[model samples]
Target: MHQNNLSDLHRFIDRPTSTWSGRNDGAGAAHRRVHQAVTSLGQGAPDSADAVFIGFASDEGVRRNGGRQGAADGPAALRSALGQLALAQGRNSLRHTDLALLDAGDVVVSSDLEEGQKKLAAAVRASVDAGVLPVVLGGGHEVAFGTYTGVADSRTRKTAGSATSQQPGRLGILNLDAHFDVRRAEQPTSGTPFYQALTRERAADTSCRYTVLGISEANNTQELFDTAHELGADYVVDEDCGVLNQQALLSTVREFVASVDIIYLTLDLDVLPASIAPGVSAPAGYGVPLEIINVVLKEVAASGKLAAFDVAELNPSFDSDGRTAQTAARLIHTVLTYYTPLSSAAPSLR
Candidate 1:
């Protein structure tokens, strides 16, 4: 039944490998890492997996906006970076043996970018159907719409009262972005995802509960802020989101997580400082540091409300020595590892 929904994802995936050289045994277990762990989401019936990854490999939305236009390659760059890390980073134990990650491959996007988003939504819906969380590797921030579509559609299928459950409460959207991305565009672009979401939610009579962190006041026009305000959206500027403000940021995240039944976390690469994540469509000259950003992300992940996740705008074409890809991968790693179920024996459904 899902064969029509998923096109070429299992066939069109990039399998990147990581090289390891060491004692090869008891001492240096270099062979045990992410690359070795991730398997194909076989015919949409993955035998076992904690999270399923789907790549959105189209940059047509970015191209339409005339921004740095190589984010089409972001998915593979993210995979390459993610495949290289140790299964368990030092100072932390990933309990790698307890995790099963599946790489579901990329959505086959053609000239029609909107169609690609639809395909992505289908792929994500399929993953959720299989009792696995979807960690989407995005071509651009435009992927947010598709990601949201999948999560929203799957809400009813979700088990009630669980974090990913579909209960009588609002769905919270938390975007870690430097710009509001709430543009009133005649056509959808990497710059108009959130606005598109808000529009859809309003039309569907879904209560809107959105909060954007790391907003750069100068990067976003006053009109965008006004639109966000009019929509009853909340925000925190870049200056107020640094590592020095950890207490404030965590409190904010905890409060927001408590108010929503489920969370769809979108991490736009541009929200990080240009010095740290320079391979996005637009680099932030003054953005949040990775350490501080991870703190809030970790809190949300462990909160059990995280339903789905998408990392966007990782343009390998603009990266220097793959620093940005690595940063994005690190965030992915943190979220996955930080998520420890309240009762491991009872795997939470997403």
Candidate 2:
């Protein structure tokens, strides 16, 4: 049965249970893995789940942006990598929780990128309403727009006992990318989602903030930098985001987290060194180190304000020995291990 009336999420194709199968070392929690903890979204409503995984299967935006394709296969490859990982030990282990691991499956995007984004938005909204964190797997950085809309719309819904408090709270978008994707375009593309988001927020006068870390000065044009500056967005160049300055970066992340009521974290894999993450449309020539990225993820997860998250630009066609997908999975695992809900109070469910 459908989770709700959010039909825009056309034909939820449940990924096979075999996709989640992996090493089983015994009956002990110490021997458990991700595949053991996760369950299909169809098993039950995600109302009681801690996190719900949703896949956006499309690379139409990349094509429009004049980049190599194949990121459309990112979701499945990511799942395969994640399924094989060992769970963290001690108190941080997912095996300790009673909550289910829900995979709601892919929102297929054919020729129409906009329509596909709408379907993704619907799926995300449904997951948010059920009080579950939406862990989105992307087809491209274009996934950012769809993910943002869902989280933004969810904040507007009239929840129980908050009819008078329908005012949407501040949203902070923290982008980990090599490029400041705020390009001017006649149509939406991988390089224009942030631009689109900024425009929408400005027109509504919402208190949303967009910040990009790990921006490669060599990759983005002067126009993009000027646009980001003119729009009042904060960003740090890749040179300034080295592992040696991790504390400073973490401080920056913490400050951003404090400023907003919630956070939406989007990672374009191209932000990492091409050697570390080579399976993206535009692999980084001198990207931020993975160690720095790991620390940032820890800070964000511990903040308890992270409402939604997505990893973008994982093009399997260019991946080397599946390294990119594995790295993405590792990052996801780190987030899952450290995430803390906003408060002890029960989340306001729709």
Candidate 3:
């Protein structure tokens, strides 16, 4: 909350003065890009917004998992790429409807991964409690654990002592990734976030549904598959998410959405082909196509159940020509364009 001291904002490098600058068409606000519409959080601004961007600038999880480490720089890179893109101009756009966007900057994790996760949870919880969608940019898939904790804690507080106290609504996680990310690690790592999430929910006796799309069979072992099954999680393998199976792939996503009370969508770039998304902790040998991924993203956004969103594993060290960042930005852009806030579409526990 260092609203005045920019450099100490998050214990890392302060947010750049204008990390989100782009073209000026000079045709007025309609012609403005994303950079034009976004405001920083904690600047004597309104308490609410349509969506807020929070960066988790930490790579400790990846380092623990024995993966490449540059993802700590992912948040800034994503902002740079997203800034230049034009805001969607149709009636459905958040900006077109006068809703606001804000950037809260990053939660820097210098060493203690667990402490970093706790800090992230607090930031995300604040946004959700304010009825704003928290669009988190990741340092690794470990971002999933913190994001889930924040959203889950918010729900718990919202339902406490209410008529629905006996039944906190089901929270469904739809992960678009190449790995199941449910490995049982001694400590939290890039590969253990989902496992942490599921265990936490179960310990609290809450309803949680975990589903994964674009899982690469070769990347995940049989033990991981067994663990998913044992935990009542569902997943669609990468081979089944190909262009030839577009209808089925979308159907699966829609069904999962319909079955859950709310959705937290997390996209891991490694779900796409290595050639398409080389900037990841682990590049996919054979991955889902971006077209199919985008279609599924649109479906989830339109479902009116999405409560939060995050993009993981964008290691710029391996990216070519900024392709991965651009792609991740495009997906974030798509979700913002079509997402129906739960407040408008449902009971408004989000």
Candidate 4:
């Protein structure tokens, strides 16, 4: 096994001052401009470029729940963590095959539920239109609706008599979470984005598919599972999949994405065991490991079908010495490295 060192961990935590101005014009500005334009237009910006990283921190429900109270700060904290991965150079320095990437800032979400979702949808749509793939950070898993809505709207425009002419293929969701997130709107908690996505009036026309991985049997409701199955979603439980062994799990994920035109990877941090990711909205005793989660993300990135992504449910209030943020950052760095071109090596960790 590759033993991790304190120096290595520390190297990925320090942020650089050179890239903070937002006018670098290299990959960073080219990345931020799309979100700036979209936010300016009050619409979700289309990702017209090769790849773009966008972050969204929706803290609406944090006030009501003690567990997720600090999720609003997750995006910024994660970005800070990712800066330590040394991504200033071309692709050759990366662990995974390099690809182009940029960091688009967070989307603005209001306190009102409906209005916030609409705003998020518009922002996401704008990002997709710019020809850039969006990698969104989260406020909660509920933001999945907005992220998916934007992607679905983009696919709707590209439909060629039932086929999409996009880089990733037909848009679908690969959600890694402890809960199914299939709760209905009767309660409207943060646990219902997938259900809303499947049951929404226009969902059928959008042709979006969902694959839920790492579900905890203790947390799921039978009715929700039945509904997900009815919607044609592939639900894999933690018990059945054997938590950290991602090879078999990734094979199943690959099968689910085989027919899709595009894939959105959504990670609810609660999918990790409570020991690893304790600062989530819902902490579970059993879940995937940190390193294994990285492998899964690497596979998704390698598949080249990744369209957009979101990592949600991080509550800093429960974090110990920012370990949760640190982990989240490493995951985000892996993602950024996955998309950056191999010719440009990531900056060496300081």
Every model: Cα RMSD to truth = 5.0, 4.4, 4.4, 10.0
Measured against the true structure, the TM-scores of the candidates, in listed sequence, are: 0.86, 0.89, 0.89, 0.74
lDDT for model 2, on a 0 to 1 scale?
0.79
Model 2: residues with Cα > 4 Å off, grouped in runs: 1-19, 45-47, 90-99, 156-166, 344-350
In the range 268-323, model 2's lDDT, one tens digit per residue, is 99999999999998999999999888878877876767778899999999986999
Off by over 4 Å in 4: 1-50, 61-67, 88-101, 155-169, 201-203, 243-245, 340-350
Question: Per-residue CA lDDT of candidate 3, range 1-350, in tens?
Answer: 10121222243323423446888887666686888768875453444467878898888999999999999989989999988888656643332234467788888887789988887887777766666778999889889898888888875334532374577778999999989888998999999999899988889888889999988889899999999998898999899988999988777876897887778899999999988888888999899999998878877876767778999999998886999999999988887766677645522212
Candidate 4, 169-260: lDDT as tens digits: 35668888888877655544477777777776244555567887788888877887787777777778877656445667767866875667
Pairs clashing within candidate 1: none
> In candidate 2, how many Å is residue 123 off?
1.0
Clashes of 3: 0
Q: Cα lDDT of all candidates, in order?
A: 0.76, 0.79, 0.80, 0.61
Global fold similarity of model 1 (TM-score)? 0.86
Which 10-residue window of candidate 2 scores lowest in summed lDDT? Answer: 1-10
In model 3, the runs with Cα more than 4 Å from the true position are 1-19, 46-48, 90-99, 156-165, 346-350
